[model samples]
Target: MWQDFGDYILSEAGDDPVKIAEIGVGKFDKISEILSEKKNITVLKTDIHPKDSTVIKDDVTNPNLELYKDVDIIYSIRPPSELQPHLINLAEKINSQLIIKPLTNEDLNTGRVKMKLKNYKKASFYILR
Candidate 1:
């Protein structure tokens, strides 16, 4: 799923260098590492409580716009339900595409996010264009 998601976002990126942000990245660097491999993409990892030095300290509920300026894509994997709207809000504010991969069978409460269910590989996620 991470490979497929990375491919999808890379496909959307075309040949231009796209700035992508992974919110609430947690301890997983699989997708981030993969995306960063591509010369046409730049990936930023953010979390409120960063587990490592690679992740920047930032809260999803109240994101730092300076850190996210010109971000082309914002995605969160298994983000807590409470912060769903904040992710959407930040994406909306930045006018970037938003992708939320909540845990399977989890509910998403994103007010006015206008997301559509996207089936990429075996991963099922929501996307706001």
Candidate 2:
């Protein structure tokens, strides 16, 4: 499942050099690690409570817009329900593609913005463009 999610993001990145941000990263970094291996993909990990020096400290509810500037894709893995809407807002404001992998069977809380449900390989997530 994790590989599938990483693969989906890689497909979006294609062969171009792109900047990607992972919001609410928490302690899990497998997806970011996978994406970072690609030379063309620049991965930025952000969380309110960063677990290490590599992960930047940022609150999704009130993110520093400068960090997301020129980012092409923003993805969050299992972000809390309350912060989902804020993710959508940030993606919209930055004009970046948004991907959210909620907990199994957990519906998104994106207000009136309807994100498309995508099934890529064994991964399932919602995408807002």
Candidate 3:
């Protein structure tokens, strides 16, 4: 499933040099690690309580717009329900594609914005563009 998620992002990148950001990246780095290895993709990991120097400190509710400037894609893996809407807001503000991999069967709290549910191989997630 993880590989599927990474592949989906890679497909979206499509050989283009694209900037991607991972929000609420607490302790998980697998997807970021995979994306970082690709020559065409630049990955940024952010968390409100960064566990290490590699994870930048940024609150999703009030994200630093500068950090997301020119970012082509923004994805969050299992972000808390309360923060999902904020993620959508940030993505819209930055005009970047948004992907949210929420917990299994967890309903999104996106309000009026409807995100499409996607199943890419074994990975299941929601996408908003």
Candidate 4:
């Protein structure tokens, strides 16, 4: 499923260099690392609690716009139900595409307009364009 998510990001990013943020990345940086290896993608991993030097410390509820200025894509892996709106808000404020990969069978709790459920390569996720 993570590979499916990564492939979706790569496809959305194309061959052009793009900035992408992974919200609430926590200790699992596999997807971010994979995306960063694409050579055209710059992945920024963020979390409220930094587990390593690579994870930036930031609160999704009130994200630091300065850190996410002009990002192309914002994605979260199994983000908490309560923080879905915050991710949506940040994506809207930055005018970036938002992708959320919630746990299997877990319904999205966000009520943001224009959110669409997408099944990319067996990866079931929500996208806000």
Candidate 5:
């Protein structure tokens, strides 16, 4: 899904300096490490229970946009269903893109976020501006 996410972002925004906000980073350093391969990207990793180095420790359903304005991409791996619309709203606000990897069998239609999926499955939902 991360690879798919990288492809989606590149296809939409290319190699520009992208501001990426990722939720549920938890203790996985690999995400940041892999994304670091992209030289022009800035990653802000977040979680409900963040360590000291985590940035923007806020809930995804109501993100602190004042701290996260102008982001170029919003990424999440199976965030709570209620937070999905907020992700879409943030992307729309910043004119960015959204990449979400949902758990198997999870539904993508909440009807709150209006999006046209480039590709979608029970396991993933990929969107672009």
Candidate 6:
């Protein structure tokens, strides 16, 4: 899943310097560690509860995009199922690409929105534009 997501990030925002905003980043510091290794990529971490560890504290559903106006990609791994719609909405608002690896409880099957699914060995991915 990580490799596939990295590939997608490279292909989607290869030429431009990109800002990647990760919502619901609980204990997953590995993501920041990985993205930080790449050049021209700034990863801003956010969560609902503000802590010294969290870079930004805001809810994904109604986020304050003012601080993240130029974000290029919004990445969420196992975000709450109810907040998936918020991700889709924010992606459209910012003209940014959304990468969501939903949890077991989240259902990606929302008939209102049309999304193309790419199934992988371990994780099934979707690209919502």
Best by TM-score: 2
| Candidate 2 lDDT for residue 80 | 89
* Per-residue alpha-carbon lDDT of candidate 3 for residues 31-116, written as tens digits (9 for 90 to 100): 99989988989899999999999999999888899999999999999999899989989999999999999999999999999999
Using lDDT as the measure, the top candidate is: 2
**Considering only N, C-alpha and C atoms within 3 Å, which residue pairs clash in candidate 3?**
none
lDDT of each: 0.87, 0.95, 0.94, 0.89, 0.67, 0.74
Superposition error at 71 for model 4 (Å): 0.5
Tens-digit per-residue lDDT, 8-90, candidate 1: 77776678978999999888878788788889888889999999999999998878899999899988889998999899889
Q: How far is candidate 6 from the true structure (C-alpha RMSD, Å)?
A: 2.4
Model 2 scores a TM of: 0.99
Sort the candidates on lDDT, descending order: 2, 3, 4, 1, 6, 5
lDDT of 6 by residue, 23-126 (tens): 88887766666777778888888889755655688887798888678998888888776778888887888888788777654568434776667565455667
- Position 97, candidate 3: lDDT: 98
Question: TM-score for every candidate vs. truth?
Answer: 0.94, 0.99, 0.98, 0.95, 0.75, 0.82
The C-alpha stretches of model 1 lying farther than 4 A from their native spots are none
Clashes of 3: 0
Residues 15-63 of candidate 2: C-alpha lDDT, one tens digit per residue: 9999999998898999999999999999999999999999999998899
Model 4 misplaced stretches (Cα beyond 4 Å)? 112-114
Model 5, 32: alpha-carbon shift in Å? 2.9
Stretch of 10 with least lDDT, candidate 5: 115-124
lDDT string, candidate 4, 22-127, tens digits: 9998888888888988888888888999998889999999888999986999999999999988888899899999999999999888874657889998788999
Q: lDDT at 57 for candidate 5?
A: 80
Clash counts for all predictions: 0, 0, 0, 0, 0, 0
Report the error of model 3 at residue 10, Å: 0.8
